[model samples]
Target chain A: MATLKVLVTGEDHAQGPEDADVTLVEYGDYECPHCGRAYPIVKQVQKHFGKRLRFVFRNFPLSEMHPHAEAAAEVAEFAGAQGKFWEMHDRLFENQERLGEALFLDLDKELKLSATAMRQALAQKTFEARVRADFTGGVRSGVNGTPTFFINGQRHNGSFDFDALVSAIQQVMITAKSA
Target chain B: MAQSGASKVTPIHSDRILPAGAGAPNFTLHATPDQTLTLSDLLGRPVILAFYPADWSPVCGDQMALYNEILPEFQKFGAELLGVSVDGAWCHAAFAESRHLHFPLLADFEPKGAVAQQYGAYRDADGFCDRALFVIDKKGIIAWSYCSPVAVNPGADGILEALEDLPK
Candidate 1:
């Protein structure tokens, strides 16, 4: 089985308790349709598991296919620098179909982040290296497609729909508790 | 009809891909209508040859797109990736344009699967190349090779591992 090459650290954008019973890492592209479909399903899974799950998000943009993916990731990282990573991440996916400079600036205004700084950072590609590092980590971890999940460090090869993900996470939680 | 006793049977070679440590077969193929890329020209850099069945196919599209995304990672190791298929240059050009692929998709269309045949990656039954990957070192020797099931998209983990294992 493929294992996570990069463990979750202070650098990752995480939610819930760090010492939760399960860690769910997702490698996702901002503009991927499949990832867009998975967005709500992941939210449901998180709600179902609540405090038992530690969710981590990593950028795995396929820039070739999705023209705005890298820039969107940079926008999220820009928000992250301002302590609003999850907010920007949610907004990006929520408006995935309208990803562009206009939407990014709008999101900046909505999130109360400085639009000028966001534009300058995007123009200079400030967060490019960080996004690329996440991408490289995903490649090393055997991620061939967007929205690849790792349940407690092991690659999740099954479907990422609500029921499948919940059952898989439950299985992991059981295994961890027993051990 | 009378059957001859003690008739001799001839053995046929299976469609087995070239194994690791074998010298990579060199060839010149069209990367575009005007440009031709020779394997020997890329002697000093590690090369990844991804032979897929065709362009526009679902599995092949995902495989190529995955490679396209991780191209920078390959470049960090000074590795060049070339996708090979029996599609014509025009077909490859259209597909690459639609997908925004940065790497060249070499067209093996002139003799139709000649290079794939040399590497034993040609699927005679299907009249196309099989899903195969070869990591050739800087010295033009295959460091590793794998043939995946046609329906599956073999991820880049094996390719990256082979590149990492190559002598620096």
Candidate 2:
């Protein structure tokens, strides 16, 4: 197998699902401004690539740096009950500070969700296992920081420009075709 | 009822400030002397919040020392700096005392990640943090924020340059 310079499995490399023409997995913290910057970019890639791409998200919440991210992840998972995962996900990234019990209720009201049900879900920590799985996946894959990504099985370090992502995907596609 | 509903809207980050251009947010962190220190306390200054995973890590040690090396330069640019981690306040005290760190190493241990949440540098699996840096101007809005790979060292000069290029 031709080794890849961009990634290492246990070192600086981040692991994710294998064998997609394009796989986009992001390691993000809900409270990170840069992660906030990268949010729309990931959405752009997902929207542009559609089903041709497999998108995965892993947690690399720098809780030492972004303390509220872990709590917010739990909150989002709790909100997943009403199928509000994406909504809570965006809300967290957009406004990271309102991540306590009170804010969750307020946000539920704003989103017209069942505050009572959401509170129950959160108290029970229904999404603990799922959040744990995502974090475990991130650690196994070597995601060392926030806002990291794996596109088509290739690890991308640093912030990305739109054109760079397209080119990387194009290269992967070409190699697959030749193989 | 509508007014009550409007009042019900949650303030996004009341204790925290948004990352905006050319301005910084007022932050009152629990510092040494076990009291509060605000961004406004350091008025007419830039602030650098250098976040790291663990105090004992090789790269983090080097990274922390870099701040001292550029202490004069940072002072010249009118910036106050601090290092933060999820370590307890006592741990921060010891780490700073042993390393002879000129700046305070903040304690973000309570709730396991208060400060990290402010900067977005928490990692759940390892229960440690990845190195992240946040630059704030005198006014207390986040000017620039960068999150680096775990083992990497963010160049001191590069960050200083980012500050220098700013409109004075």
Candidate 3:
């Protein structure tokens, strides 16, 4: 996370549109409780910034401690293929414990994804590579903890609180607008 | 806030920590092949006892990644790095796979916080071990040891330096 500010350029980024005013890229672990706690703050940033900001999720699972983190990313990836990656991402983070491999398949059906296809994807280790790539990029980005953020190409490493996020964004917005 | 340094650290009451120059004590932990590895088993080789605060903390991530990067060096020096935490073996396997990490994340679960307590690294209120590193020489005597606050850490290079300084 400390190195995030220097890592804005990389092959692992998920691009938004050309004219997006603010691009918020996050390096996060699925099972890190701190990441879970940051979920709401990120949501608020999206709310506060609205269409002016583009938010991206980068998976940085701390699988060493939380065995279910990578699978959780896969569930989101599976849902992504069905055009619901964000939906599934939010769902998995909101209820991480309930989304193990068994629970993931169940939720796939709940989210209207093809359970058979989803299972196949998981079996094929489809998004495993993508998750790895993101994690490796996270390493390159100096991401060591959950919910590491880059607000407009600058890293913010501190407590996972929303007020902190809002202030950072507000300061950036004023500076960007003035410039 | 928790007390800093020696006065605040009492492993037996909380995590069971061993002070420097003391015996590393005997304990069994789950290794990479899913086998139980004991401190006594690694007696013949110099051991790098890596204590990370948690599996995914940022500093901890850098610390383990650093060790993985220097695995060959450690092996050349005839050493084994054993990471201990409250996390389970199952989590360790996934952790290794995800990071392409080439080390073992020993499970200090069950007996709850016994090993961490033994090392005086556990913070009972937080339910996690603090960052601590110990280098035990081949004879099973601690040669060098260092501990850090939960958020900050001393780099792995210092331990490697200590290892080189310790009698090989």
Best by lDDT: 1
Stretches off by above 4 angstroms in model 3 are A1-18, B1-168
When only chain A is evaluated, what TM-score does every model earn?
0.99, 0.75, 0.87
List each candidate's DockQ score: 0.23, 0.02, 0.07
Docking class of 3: incorrect
A5-53: candidate 3 lDDT, tens digit per residue: 2344444334455456777788776777777878888888788877777
Q: Which of the two candidates, 1 or 3, achieves a greater TM-score against the reference?
A: 1
Report the Cα lDDT for candidate 3: 0.71
Q: Model 2 - which docking category?
A: incorrect
lDDT of 1 by residue, B1-168 (tens): 001111231222223999998999999999998999999999999999999999998768888999998887899899999999999999999999988899999999989999999998998888999888999999999999988766656679889999999999
Per-residue lDDT of B1-168 in model 3, one digit per residue for the tens? 001233343342312456668888778877754598889988888899887767766566666765675566578778898888787888878777767788788888888668878777777888887778888999999887777656544445556667778774
Which CAPRI tier for candidate 1?
A: acceptable
lDDT of each residue in B4-27, candidate 2, tens digit only: 112333332222333446344345
DockQ of 3: 0.07
RMSD of each: 8.3, 18.4, 9.5
Worst 10 residues of 3 chain A by lDDT: A1-10
